[model samples]
Target: MKILVVDDDPMVLEVLKHSLAHSGYDDVTVAQSAVEASQIIAKANPAFECFLLDMSMPEIEGDDLCYWVRQLPQYASTPILMVTALANKRDIDRAFAAGASDYITKPIDMSDFGMRIQQIDRKNSQNAFKAPASISLLDKQDQEPDRIDFSKPVHLGEITGEVDLASLENYLLQLSRKGIEGLSAFAFTIADAAKFHFVCTTEEYLDILKSTGQIISDHLAASGFFLSYAGSGSFVGVGQNANLHHDEWEKTERSIQEALAKVAVPSSLGLPSKIQVFSGVPLRLNGKYAERSLDILYRTIVEAEDRCGDTSWAQV
Candidate 1:
């Protein structure tokens, strides 16, 4: 549904955006600061079904944002999901006191993230959850078989200036330095391009992803990647998940758009928002030749650029 993801860290925002996108909720808006987030919310009234906010932010805190949101005449009952690194009871209690509907710790789990979102959706639902299938909120998309090559290193070719390339690089370096076991996910801040961008080998890194999903989600939310989008409102995603075919990948991307469509927002701004999914052939991830992986992603981005063809999200 129409949810606002507020975070200051660009990398975390990307991760959360990706996480939610993966979860099938596509209409996600991100705001780096609470002020910008408020502007979007006021503009899109009676929409923004939920808010995934970071507990800490510059100028405004997540708790304060929750309080402000609760005070909004149209959002008196809106759900606010707090993303926090601290699991202290007092901190959670403070969030609740400020009007948070739920709180997820720094490291968020995919299963837990799904369950929490489902719970929130159920609560917002008019009737009680009848059955698994009856809960239609979950978008219907075929799950792709996990196919990732992890025997070698990954590639990270030329980092785009639009993305937090440095942060990503540092994160990868830390992973290599401390070793994957000791280091956790990396966080970053950059201009809003999309929600998140990640590079990993599926077959070998599946457990790593699952194990770090929670932490990744948490860091993203806590940093502000989970905030609402204050940019043009259009998202361009390019990736090659070796496990998914071109058509299957398109379907998966469509599911995200469909999910975001469910959120009803004010059309006055005419924000032409759409999810464009592109795919290419699979490649090897030698880890050492990380450029190969980046090449796949870069090609996808280039394709998106050609298709975007002066069509801005603001016009939609």
Candidate 2:
């Protein structure tokens, strides 16, 4: 795949170029800064297929550059991995909020970097999602969208702080058990959303998803959190839990429910008048029985979904 690498550091740029070639991705382009990257993008013959951007720069920081790239229709759904510092929690969160697909830490590890690229390539082989040509009609007549893939994660566009599901998983995989010490993961799911999906128009269903995603980011707003909406009417996230008490998650759940209550979701399609949102216990990332980030990530998702024979119900 054609690739673009943006970093102000000359050595880092050369190292990344060599690494990509090692992984058999030789069609790589290099840019020293955001302005240079923009210039290259505007005049390219065949558009670059992927982007590797440093999260920090002297001016026009990486997050801002990511936002600029996402605004372009063609690259909206393309892979844009960030190169970040493991200790910079706030910057990592900003990158995700700005629509970065995934990130690799600085002081790059040569051995593992190739594995990350291979993972991305596998998905591309599966025909990763591409941006739609145009917006869907907003009228009530909007038919329900194509079958809701319970396992697939859809894009929530610019407003929702959405990170790709695979990207989120890759982030977790990159962390060591100790690296996850201060973080926790949670899931937010709409009760009986499948019923709503079948009855609501395409616009309404998407609106439900957009609203759920917005509420997750708005209510659970944190400087170190990143969220992903995995299908089945849910968003799963990992964030800094130092400031959030166990009880705080319950409150956030209630807040989300209260916020969702005001939307007046149309009931004509065999849907409930009011929808309820639920949160499973936040799984502490470094807790006992969670020896690996991937394992703990799924455990949190299961807890949020309350599908492991836990008691949970809609309050509305």
| Top-TM-score candidate index | 2
Give candidate 1 regions above 4 Å deviation.
127-316
Query: Which residue pairs show backbone clashes in model 2?
Result: 143-202
| Regions more than 4 Å wrong, model 2 | 84-87, 128-145, 158-160, 175-180, 221-223, 242-248, 287-291, 307-316
Q: Candidate 2's residue-wise lDDT over 45-97, tens digit each?
A: 78777899998797888889998998887787778889865445566667777
What TM-score, over all chains together, does every model reach? 0.40, 0.83
Question: What count of clashes does model 2 give?
Answer: 1
TM-score of 2: 0.83
Instruction: Report per-prediction Cα RMSD to one decimal.
Output: 20.7, 4.2
Q: Positional deviation of 272 in candidate 2, in angstroms? A: 0.6
Q: Candidate 2: lDDT over CA atoms?
A: 0.73
Q: Which 10 consecutive residues of model 1 have the lowest summed lDDT? A: 221-230
